[model samples]
Target: MVSLRLRLGKAGRRWLLLFHRWAGIVAGLFFALWIGSGLVMLYVPFPTLTETERLARLTPIAWDQVAVAPDDALRAGGAVGLPAAFNLEMRGGEAVYRIAGRDGNRATVSARTGARLGPLTPEGALRLATEGLPDGRVEPVERDQWTVTARYDPLRPFLKVALGDPAGTELYVSQVTGEIALDTTQFERAWNWVGAVTHWIYLTPLRARPELWRTILLWLSGFAALGALSGLVVGIWRLRLRRRYAGGSVTPYRGIARWHHLFGLAGGIGLSTFIVSGWISMNPYRWFSSNAAPAEIRAAYAGAPPPLGLDAATLRGFAEPGTRGLRFVAIGGSWWIVTDGLAGTQGRRAADGLPLTVDAITSAAARAVPGGALRAVEPLAGFDTYWYPHGADPRPLPVLRLRFDDPAAIWLHVDPRDGAILQRLDLSGRINRWLFDGAHRLDLPGLTGSRRLHDAAQWILNLLAAGIAVTGLVAGWRRLRRTLSA
Candidate 1:
């Protein structure tokens, strides 16, 4: 029995060494690229149009020309019940109602003539793209490297317009919706090739097919996790603290192998966790559910379609000089108007045109989660465990957190200003937050509270990871040469 146990142990050690060595050879380069590119992404995130930026450029809604009432415009747009999304904004110097129905239909109705508008022509797209800037050129494109992701699917066949500005900015206007879908500057385009593009493997051809891209990421990250785990185990087994090596060193290796041993011992656990978390991000078994509020749940919360009972004069009174547009929202069985402008999004009572009171906002949040007893309502003035800002996407602060007593133990974060649902977290979602964001982004509550501390910790860990990869590459190269020579 003793002999058999010894044999099994020896065989296991041999297999572990072989697995770690060969896995390193296969995935070492990619690990290095991921770590390096992740650092680059820390500072220069992928270019995106933020809500504030989008609203800043939009001309204030032409309320004088808006002869059609909000209710009349909905009828003209052929909306049955409360539409999925009802946005009134200026498109190419015309105030239009963009109504998205729950039945997967969309319509753009002119506010002036109450006429349904069709898709934009190339000339119209160019005009929309260069609304505020000097137009340089316009070219129609189906897909490109920057606009290859599936999120831009609804706005396909974009018209790329170059603005002859100092920033070398290019805007992509949706031919279907005539909205400025995306904008990229020279600096953002140049850095993103090595940052987000390489980090996410977001090359146009691969990313165009989202499922294939996800599959590749799943398999590759899975293997990388395997490799990292094996290395971590091997590292711990070989590390000697009390009883040192023959040469009074903790590791039984020389030169590059010694560096690899030391770095692996230091950073292997973190590297393994990061890789595992990245694998989890692909959602291997579909264990995590989407956090979006369901259609029925949202409809229940809305209570009824927002009434456009207010007139043009009343609506015009709500606007300031830079007010971009106004949206009709249903909150707690009452209609409210949310104004988007230079001052940011603010809610007003549709009937009285008064600012939304705190009591009203809190009352509306109670109706959001039906059939669940309201356990607690916590107001978050800053980042917390579940509510935190991501890179380039700053989550609105001063949010109202509603906890429910449902089987899912659901939590909802509502915008205090507009009573909009910002995020929904259930049992599975909370688990995934730690598995993905906590492990991968180091976004723990303690670390996230202080930007300086988070940045410092990440930099130190990333440097150690980079060292491990560099030494692994050297060792792998040596092994390859020896195999060839042998």
Candidate 2:
């Protein structure tokens, strides 16, 4: 039995070593790229237009010129029912109502003429893109690296206009809707080649095909994770801690090999965790639920839409001193006009045009989870485990959190500022949050609480990972050359 056990152990170790070595040779470059690009991504995230930035860029609503009411615009736009989202904003110097129906139908109606609007021409798109800027050039693009993702498909065929500013900013204006879909500065574009582009494998050709990209990422990361696990096992098995190796050294290998072992021991677990979490980010096999509030949940929260007796005059009255735009939304079976202003987002009871209090928002949140018992409604004055801030994506604070006692254990984070469902985290969502966000982003208590600490810890761990990858790459290359020679 002892002889058999010894033979089996030797065979298992040999197979493990062979697998780790060949896998390293195959995926060393990918590991190196992931580690290096992750460092760059620490500072430079992918480009996104935040709500604050969007509000600031928008030309304030020309309310007086808005002759068509919300109801009138909905009718003229051929909307079947109450719109899922209805907002009035200035589009190419015209007051337009962007109405999105529950059934995924979207239409733009001219507030001035009550006429259905069509997609913007190149000139109109350029005009909208470079409203107050000194334009240098305008070029139409079907797709580019920055705007290549599927999220921008609905707003395809953008007009890229370079603003002759100090920042060398470029704006991608959606020809479909005349909206500034994305903006990239010279610095962002230059660094993103090494940062987000490399990190996400976000080349336009591959990413344009969503399924292909996802499949590739899953395969790559999955293999990389296996390699990491094998390396970790070999690292532990080879490490002689108490009984030490020759010359009192814990590691037998010298120079780069020695360093690889050491660094692997230090960072192998973390690297494995990160790679696995990154794979989870793709939501393979649909193990996690979407964070977005479902349409039914949103409808239940909004309740039956009361007749929005809003006319041009009433909407104009809803505008405050620096109100940029007005959104007609539903809350607690009633309608409310939400104003995006220079001060911030504010909501008013549409029936009386009175300011909404906290109680009104809380009451609406209670109905968000259909058929579930409302357990508790707590106020999140700051960021929490599942509601922490994300880079370039702002999470509103002072939110009202509603916990439901259901099988799914739903938790809704409501933005009291405008009565919007900011996030919906259920059981799978919370678990995914930890698996993806917590493990991948290191969004733990200490790390995220302090920027300096987070950066320092990331730098250390990434450097360790880099050391392991670099040494493995070198060793793998030499091994390949030797094998070929043999």
Candidate 3:
């Protein structure tokens, strides 16, 4: 009886051990890739260039000094290697033109002086994306209601251009005098396509065709998750096998395998969380609402007073107490004040003094809520809590500027006008919103630290995933060869 029991136990242990080893070897590589890609995406900057950088590329020509026509400028500067669809924006002092091409090379030129500003050089852009704005960051200059002036290099000639949502607007500013020209047309349409690409992976028709890439990623991620789980099971099985067959003798390779199993187990959980959140974020119709009601409710809870149609100037005054370093204001039916708060701080607030049903008519001391409040409801639904600006720009919009508070905490939104509670959304909630919005943006302890950690993890995982795939193929090949030989 005892001998029979021992034999059965030994067989079970061998089976479990084989399962664990195969599972680990199979899933290790993919698990690493998903995590690595996620980390790379965390810090990658959006495609939009800073105002200063954009303007700097164009050698400033005197407003009175008009040298060439659009065609002449292109001819003088040499053939523009861009798509035919790119348009031109020329005024008294400045002339700017952009062209898109097949190779993802976009060129921006200063047409006034016929100077080759630069090809929004992909390499340079990528560098800027990796290494973000400098440390002693000044407040972003506000342009229009939805536009903010981002300075690339403060010491050099600053570029004061306006952007609305994530789209580029036609900003007419004096090239020589650096004065605001005519706010004729906002370049919302221009950036619409660009923003769409950045916001959703489905920007290009090719990308959207059968939603191939996304679908592939989904399946890949799913497989990766399965592989990881299987790996854990296999690893556990292997331990039992070792105990039964080897009589507690452990090989060095087995130890190494064991370590891999442990790390994979933990990393697997993190990767799974990210994947699930990311998938949920991609499906907005089923998850989020676009209209302003949910936003309003969230704002009200945050203590923001109702909106009142106040002119930009009045709104500025009402907001001055809470917002220092006021820059510019945009007054339409609703007023949006662009203020330069402390360095590295940026935010937005909306208010309506009248009742919910009444149209906001006055810019009086009505309560207002910051934009961040609307972002905090995402994570509870099992999504990551990073904020992603959905409509246009690929970058996460900063609707409220708060210093590095607890990343996990959601600060109270006060009405800039009345200091009332506007709304409250936690960091997790914001992360969830971002997950739906299609990006992972976590403001970690420090830029350097975060980037280093993310980059290192990515590098490790990608290599491992690639290695695993290769090894698995080799192993299968060897097994087939042996079987044939036998």
Candidate 4:
């Protein structure tokens, strides 16, 4: 038993040494890459044309040209599902009605006539594809995944149209929607390989198999975290401020070895936290954080329809020239026309067209939560404790805030459009947004307006950890070479 214990200790040390040695060699490159790429990502986001951007690029809709009303468009669409919302928007300067079903299906029909424009014509597709180019020259359209993946799933079977520009730009125009889904410049294409692709191991070949990539990353990060921890332990054990082994200095090891040991000791906690947070980000089941499901949101849209006599013509007259869309939401036997955008701004209900009384809206909102009772109903004039905008998730201004009596202490930000709850912040959501987001991204509420300072702080800490990664890589390489020679 004594012999077994001794052998076990030797084996444990051997394995731990090997594990740390190899994890550093492998994942150190990724660590450097993740930090560098993360810095780049902060500035240049993955290419996406937002709705506001799309609207800003287009001209105002011709009210005279819109002969077919939304009612006519609905009939023309031949929609099998119940219409939840009717939206009027310009696509390439042509007005179209986008009818959304409660099941998340959307059908687009021409506003000029009640005809269903199923897909873009070849000519139409080519025209949109070349819109971005200064000198219009184009190659023949082809059906392929040239500028598509799971990310562009909504806009699939794309028409790949290569431009004749010097940069070799290719635009992916959606065959279904007849819209420019993605625009890839030569610079964006080249830099992306170095930035996101190498950082994520997200080559088309590997990225296509999402599950495999996820599994590989999870295991890699796990071992890397373990390696950082082990390094911390080893660094502490080897630390002797007075005693000297190789060099007659405080640190036993000389040069790079000493640098590696000290940095590991200093940055081990951060390395572990960063790597563990990265792993947690890939947790789709959201075991670590609360995820708001669509089903849970549907709890608010329950019960019978609220009866309010309203129609498209009345809503149309209420719309601004730059209005993007309109939605007729019924709440508590009252109706409202939610006018979306008039030249890039927050949506608002029509003047004198109120949906439900404040009391009625609060009561209805309370009923949305299973056991919730209305606690306080206040008008959120500006950013408050629970209803501030974060990243791309926008908070519509002039919102109706409803506090509830549920154990979770749910707060719903109801859109003035039709008393529809735009945001729901329960205890779990607060924990996820405030606690998890604050720690993982270093986005504390105190630094809300001071983004520049936050970024500077982030860069400093990340650069320190990066120093550790660099030293570990160099040390691991030399050690591997030594082991091979022995």
Query: How well is each residue in 1-486 modelled by candidate 2, as lDDT tens digits?
Result: 999999999999999999999999999999999988988998999988777878888878877679987888888888886678888888867888888778766688899999998877777766777767765578999988998877777677788889888888888887666778788899999899999999999999999899999999999999988999999999999999899988999999997888889999999988888888888898889889999999888987888876787778867888888777889888888889999976888899989978877788778777778778778888989887777776666688898888998889999888887889888999999998889888888888877778888889888888888989999999999899999999
lDDT of 3 by residue, 1-486 (tens): 999999998887676666645554555454434444443344443334443333333332233333334344434444333222233433223544433332333344564566666422223322222223232111223233222222212112223333332332333332222322222223433343333333344333434344465575566555545554555455444444335545463322344344454444444444444445555544433344332224343333333222334332343343323232222112223323333322222334435323221112112112223333222211122112232222123332222222123343543332232222223445544555545332233323332234466456545544544444444445545555787799
TM-score against native, each model: 0.95, 0.96, 0.39, 0.81
Off by over 4 Å in 1: 132-135, 358-364
Inter-residue clash pairs, candidate 4: none
Candidate 4 regions exceeding 4 Å error are 1-15, 83-85, 128-152, 160-171, 180-190, 208-210, 241-250, 288-293, 302-312, 328-335, 342-352, 355-364, 371-428, 434-436
C-alpha positional error of residue 323 in candidate 3 after TM-score superposition, expressed in Å = 21
What is the C-alpha local distance difference test score of each model?
0.85, 0.86, 0.37, 0.65
- Candidate 1 achieves a global lDDT of 0.85
Model with the higher TM-score, candidate 1 or 4: 1
Please estimate how well model 3 matches the true structure, expressed as its whole-model Cα lDDT: 0.37
RMSD of each: 2.0, 1.6, 15.3, 4.3
In model 3, the Cα lDDT at residue 337 comes to: 31
- Rank candidates, TM-score, best first: 2, 1, 4, 3
Question: How are the candidates ranked when ordered by lDDT, highest leading?
Answer: 2, 1, 4, 3
Residue 183, candidate 4: alpha-carbon lDDT: 68
- lDDT value, residue 172 of candidate 4: 70
lDDT (Cα, 0-100) at 218 in candidate 2: 92
